[model samples]
Target chain A: MSTRLLRLLAPALLGTLMVTAWYGVHLWLDTEMRFLLPTPVQILGAFRDNGESLGRAALNTAEGALLGFGGAALVGFLFAVVLSLSSLVRASLYPYLMILQMTPIIIIAPILVLWVGAGLKSVAIITFLICFFPLVVNTTQGLISTDRNLVELFAMWRTGRWQQLVHLRIPSALPYFFTGLRIAATLAPIGALVGDYTAGNSDGNGGGLGFQAIIYSSQAKYPALFATAAVTCALGFIFTGAVVALSWLALHRWHDSYERADR
Target chain B: MAVPPIVELREVTKRFGDGPLVLDRLSLAAQPGEFISLIGPSGCGKSTLLRLIAGLSPVTAGTLRVDGVTPDAAAAELAFVFQEPTLLPWLTVGRNIELAPRLRGISAMDRAATRQRVLDLVRLGNRADAYPRQLSGGQKMRVSLARALALEPKILLLDEPFGALDEMTREHLNEELLAIHAEAKWTGFFVTHSVAEAVFLSTRIVVMAANPGRIHSVIAVDLPRERTNATRASRAYLDLVADVSQLLRSVESTAA
Candidate 1:
C-alpha cells in the first residue's frame, strides 16, 4: 500500500485488533471474574448510555490541555531564547530549570490544588509545567546548533544578530520544535488528567477524564470505566492528531523530518 | 600602468586559541578579475586563510586588506562560498539568493533584481521557487553561487565550493564558474585540494605547505582565456596539472 493509505489504515487496524483481543480475554476469563472485565459490547453500551457525560469530561480536559500547551509553548520558547542568548544566563539558570523539570509533578499537584484552589486553570498550570522543558531544551539546542559554515557565511555578509536569529536560527529550530511538540502532545493529556484527578470537582461535570476514571472505578460500573478509558485513548489520539496535523502544515514543505513522513 | 590590487595580505600570521600556528607570516595579493587558487593538504589551514580574507576569522598579526581597507570593513565587497552548498534548506532558491543582500539592508527592489539576474546567470531562473531539498548537488551549488553574486561583490572567496561534488559535476561547475567570473569580472580566491581543478580554473595556483601553512610555490596557469573541455584535453593543460601535482607531492612530503 502507499504510505498515505498505510498511515490512515494503521491506527484503525490496531484499534480493531485491540478491541478483538479485549473481547477474547473477556470470554476466556472465569464467569466469577467476568464481572470485573467488560466485553466490547458492554463497553459500547456504556458509551451509548453515558456519552454526554464522558464527552463533557473529555471536552473539559481537552480545553485545559490546549490552554496548557499554548502557555507552555510561549513560556518555553521565551525561556529558551533568553537562556540561549548568553552563556552566562544559560549556565546560571539551566540548573534551576532542570530541577523544576525533575521535581515530581504528582507530589506537587495536590499541593498546587491547595495553593491555587481547584479548576480548569489549575489543571492547565499543571499541564504547562509538564510540557515546558522539552520545548525549551530542543529549541535551545536548535538555536545554538546552526552549522558553523552558515554562521561564517552570515558573518561574512555582516548580517546583524537579529537577522541571524530570525532567518538562520528560527528556521533551524523548527524541526526540533516540532519533535518537542510531538513529545509534549503525549505528555499533555497525562498532565491534564493528573490535574483533574487532584483538583477538579469530584461530584460535578468539570472533573476531566482522570476524574471520570476515578468515579467510574469507585462506583464499580466496570463497563463505563472501560468505556471511559477507551474514550480517553480516543481523546489522546485526537489531541496528538491535532499536533501532528499542525506539524505537517508547519514543516511539510522543507524539513526532512516531515519530508520523510510525507513519503 | 598599474591598477591597485583588489586584495593584499602582508606578513599575515594566524594562530588559534593559544594553539599552534595555522598560517605564519604569509603574504599574497590578487589583482582585479584574477582567479587565484590555493591548494594544500588537509591540515594546511587553506580554509582558515579563506576565512581570514572573508573577515570571518581574524589574523593574529600583520595586515590583510581588500581594496586597501581592512577585511572587516571590506566585507560588503566580498562574498564567500563555503565548501558545503550552504543554502538554507528551508528557503526557496530565490529567497536564499535574496537573503544576504537583504541582511545587508539592500533595498527590496535591488535585491529582487539582483536575485533575478544571478539566478539567470546560474541558469536557475526557472527554479526560483524550488527549495534546497528539491535540488540536486550541482543545482544547490549554483544557488550558492547565485547567493554570492546577489551581493554584487567585487571579490569572491570560495573555500573548495565544488569539492563535495563528483568529478563530472565538479568539472561542469568549474567551467560555469569561470564563465560567470569572466562575465562578472570579480577577483576570485579559491581553496581546493584537487590540483587538476586548481590548474583548470585558476590564473594562478599557490601551493602551500602544512604545519605553519605558508606558500611553497606559485604556478601561473597558461591556458586559453576562455577554457573549454578542449583546454582540459589539450597537451599544455595536462602538463600544467601534472606540474602542480608534482609540486603538491613535494610539499606534502616535506610537511610529513
Candidate 2:
C-alpha cells in the first residue's frame, strides 16, 4: 500500500488490535466468573455462523435509513425554502424546529414507535426526526446569507422574488444543504437502529440487530452480542463514509473545503 | 439641440436613521449627454447623492427626479454603479449583464443582443462564461460597468466606480470611461475623490465639503474633447486639476 493509504489505515488497525487485547481480558474474566466480554476469535466465529441472518437484518436497517434520509431531505429543503421566503413562517416555525432538534432521539423513538406501530414506518420516522434538523438549519442559513448587494442588483432590474429564489437562493444553498445531508447521513444508521430497539421485534419474532443486542445480553451470549455490535459499527462507518464522498463530489466544483489540502 | 436636463435634483436632503444629515438641500441637474463628476472626501455623501438619483434610497426631504420625472416614474431611464463590484457572484458575466433588460420584459433574443453589444462595448466579450471568482478586480469592475451600460439608460449614476483599483488601473479605466461616454453620449454623474480623474473624464466637476455634504464649487473643464494619455500632460488639464485640488484643500481646512 502507498504510505498515504497506510497512514489512513494505521489508526483503524491500532484500534482493532486494542479491541482484541480487551477481548482477551474479557475471555480471561469469563473463565473466572462474569461472561460480559467475549474473545475476538470466538466473536469472529459467531459472526461467521450468523453472517447470512445478520446480512439480511443489515439490509432491512439500510432500507429504513435510506428511505428516512431521502424523505427528510425533501421535507427539510421545502421547509428551508419556506423559511427563507416568509419571515412570518420562520418566526412562527423556527422555535418548533429548535424543539424538534433538541428533543432526545431515544425519548422520541419510543413515542414514534407507539404512534406509527412496528416495522418500517416507525424506523423511518425515527431516522427522519434525527436527520431533518441539520438539513433545515444549514439550508436556511445558506439561503439567507446571499450577498445584499447582489440582491439589490436583482431588485433594481425588477427580478421577481420567485425568480431570485430559483436562480440565486437555491444554488447558493446547495453547498450548505449538502453539508447538512452529510452529517445527517452519519446519524441516520444510529437513528434506524434505535428505532428498531424501541419499536419492538420485526415480524413479531426476529429481533433486528439492536433487539438481538438486548436478547444476547439477556442470554449471556457475549461473543454473539459483540459480533453483532461490530457489524453495527461497521454499518455506521460505511454510511458516514458514503455521505462524505457524496458531499465531496457535490461541492468539489465550487467550494474549497472539499478540495484536498496540499502539504 | 435644445433637450432639457435628463435628471434634476431639487433641494434634495438625506439623513440616516437618527443620525446627522448626509446630503443637505443639494440641488443639481444633468443636461442630456453631459458628463459631471462629484468629488469630495470619504464622508461627503457623494454616494448618498448618487443613490438619491438612482432611487435606491428615498430622499429625506425635497424632490429627487430623473429624466424630469420622479425616480419611481423614470425607473427605465436611470442606471447606477456602486463603489464595489456588485456583480452577482453566482451568475456568469453575460447573465449578470443581461439581468436588467430581462427583468424589464424584453424578449430573450433581444436581451442577448443587448448583452453582447454592451459586453463588446466594455471589452469583456470573451469573459461571458467565467464566474466572478475567476475575474481580476479590474475585470469584475468592468463586468459591473457592462451591467449598468446594458440597461442603456439615459442617465448613469456612478459612486466612485474605480475607487478600489490601484492608481494605474484607475487611470486606465478613466480613459476607457471617457471613450464610452464620448460614443454613447449618456448623461453621467460620477462621484470620486481624485482631482485629476474628475478633470480628465468630466465636462464639469462638482466639488463638495464633508459633514452635511454640499457643493463647494463647480469647475468646468475646458480641455479638448479628445482626451488621450497626452491630455493628462496638457496645461489646461493640469490647471483644472490644480483648481479642484485648491477647492478640496480649502474644504478640508475649513472642516478641520
Candidate 3:
C-alpha cells in the first residue's frame, strides 16, 4: 500500500486491536464476577432484545445533551465577548465563572435537579452548568491573545471595534473555541446522565441511560446494565468526534493551524 | 510659499508615563511628495515621532498635523509600516493587503483591484494566497509594504520597515520603495539608523540625537533625482552619508 494509505490504516488497526484486547479481558472478568460483570456477547444480546426501549431512552438523553450544550455555547461565547470588550466585566464576573468551573458537578447536579424538577429540564440544567466554563475560558483567552501589532494595524486602518471583533478576534479564536466544544460535547452527555441518575423520578419519561443502569443493577440484570453503559460510552465518543469533525470542516479554511494539521 | 506642508511637527514632545522625556520640542516640516528620513541612535524617539504623526499616540505637548488636520482625522490618508512585517498571521497576503480598503467599506471589486495592484507593485502577486508564516522574511515585509500601499495613501510613515531584513533583501526593497514612491509621489517619512539607506532613498535626511531626543541637523541630498544601485557609489551619496555620520558622532560626544 502507498504511504498515505498505510498512515491512515495503521491507527485504525491499532485502535481495533486495543478494543478487542479489552473485550477479552472483560469476558474473563464476567466468568469470575457473575453479578458484577457481563460478557460483551451477553451485553450485545441484551441490547438487541431491548433495542426499542433503549433507543427511546437514548433519544431522551440526546435531547437533554443537545439542549444543554447549545445553551452553554451561546452563554459562554457572549460571556467571553463581554469579558474581552470591558475590563470591568472581566474583573467583576470572572472569579464567579472560575468558581462555577471548579465546583464538583456531582455535588451541583442534585441541587439543580431539586430546583428545576425531574426530566429534560433538570438534566439539561446540570449539563449546561458543567460544560459552560471551559468554552468561556478558552474563547476569552484566544480572543485576547491575538497579535498586538495586528491590533495596532487594525487601529491604523481605522477599523471600528465591532469590525475588529467580528473580522479578527472571532476568527482567531475558532481553534480554541472548538477545542472547548469537543470537551463539552463529551461532558454534556455524561453530565446529563449524572443528573438523570441523581434526580430521575423513576417515571418512564424521566429514566434515561443512567437511570436505566441503576434500575437494571438493582434488579441484578447484569448484561442489561452493561449494555446501557456501553451505549452511553459509545454516545460520548460519537458526540465528541462529531463536534471535532464539524469544527474542523467549518474552520479549516480560515485558520492555518487547522489546515496545517489536516494536511 | 503658497503650498501647505504635507506634514508638520511643531515643537512636539513625548514621554511615557512618569519616564524621562523621550522627544523634546521636535519641529520639522515635510514638503509635499518629499522623501524624508530620520536617522538617529536607538532610543532617540524617532519611532515615537512617527507614531505621533500616525496618530498611534498623542504628542505630550505642541502641535502635530498632517495636511493641517489632527493626526486622527488625517490618518485616513496615512499608512504606517512597522519594523516588523506585522502581517496578521491568520490572514493570507492578499487578505492582509486588502485590510485598509476593507476597513473603509470600499466595494468588493474595487478592494480586489487595489489588492492586486499593490501586490503587483511589491512583486508579491503570485503569493497572494500564502500565509505570513509560509513566506520568507523579505516576502513578509513585501506583504506589509503591499498592505501600506493598498490604501493608495498620501503619506507613508515607515518606522524602520526594512530593519529586520538581510542587506540584499533590504537593498531590493529599497529600490522597490523608490519605484512605488516615484509612481505615487506620496510624502514619505521613514525612520532608520542606516546612514547609507537614508542617503540613498531620502530627499532630505534629518539627523537626530538621543537623551531628550532632538533633531541635530537636516541635510538635503543633491544626488540625481533618479536613484539606482549605481547611486550608492556616487560621490554625492557618500558625502551625504559622511555628513549624517558626523552629526551622529557629535551627538554621541555631547551625550558623553
Best by TM-score: 1
Q: Highest DockQ: which candidate?
A: 1
- CA shift of A152, model 3, Å: 1.1
DockQ of candidates 1 onward, in order?
Answer: 0.75, 0.39, 0.51
Model 3 lDDT, residue A82, Cα = 89
lDDT of 3 by residue, B123-220 (tens): 98898998787788999998898888888889999999988888999999999999999999999999988998998899999988899899888889
Which of the predicted structures, 1 or 3, would earn the higher DockQ when compared with the native? 1
TM-score of every candidate? 0.93, 0.89, 0.90
Q: Score candidate 1 by TM-score against the native.
A: 0.93
Give each model's whole-structure lDDT: 0.87, 0.82, 0.85
Task: Quote the lDDT for B168 in model 3.
Answer: 98
Model 3 alpha-carbon miss at residue A184, Å: 1.3
Alpha-carbon runs more than 4 Å astray in model 1:
A1-21, A24-33, A202-206, A260-263
Lowest lDDT sum, 10 consecutive residues, model 1 chain A, at A198-207
Native contacts present in candidate 2, fraction: 0.29
Candidate 1: the clashing residue pairs are none
* Interface RMSD of the candidates, in order: 0.9, 2.4, 2.4
Error of 3 at A206 (Å): 6.9
User: Residue-wise lDDT of candidate 2 within B85-187, one digit each (tens)?
Assistant: 9876656898888877776788999988888888888788888888776788999998899889888888888888998999999988988888999998889
The DockQ-based order of candidates, best leading, equals 1, 3, 2
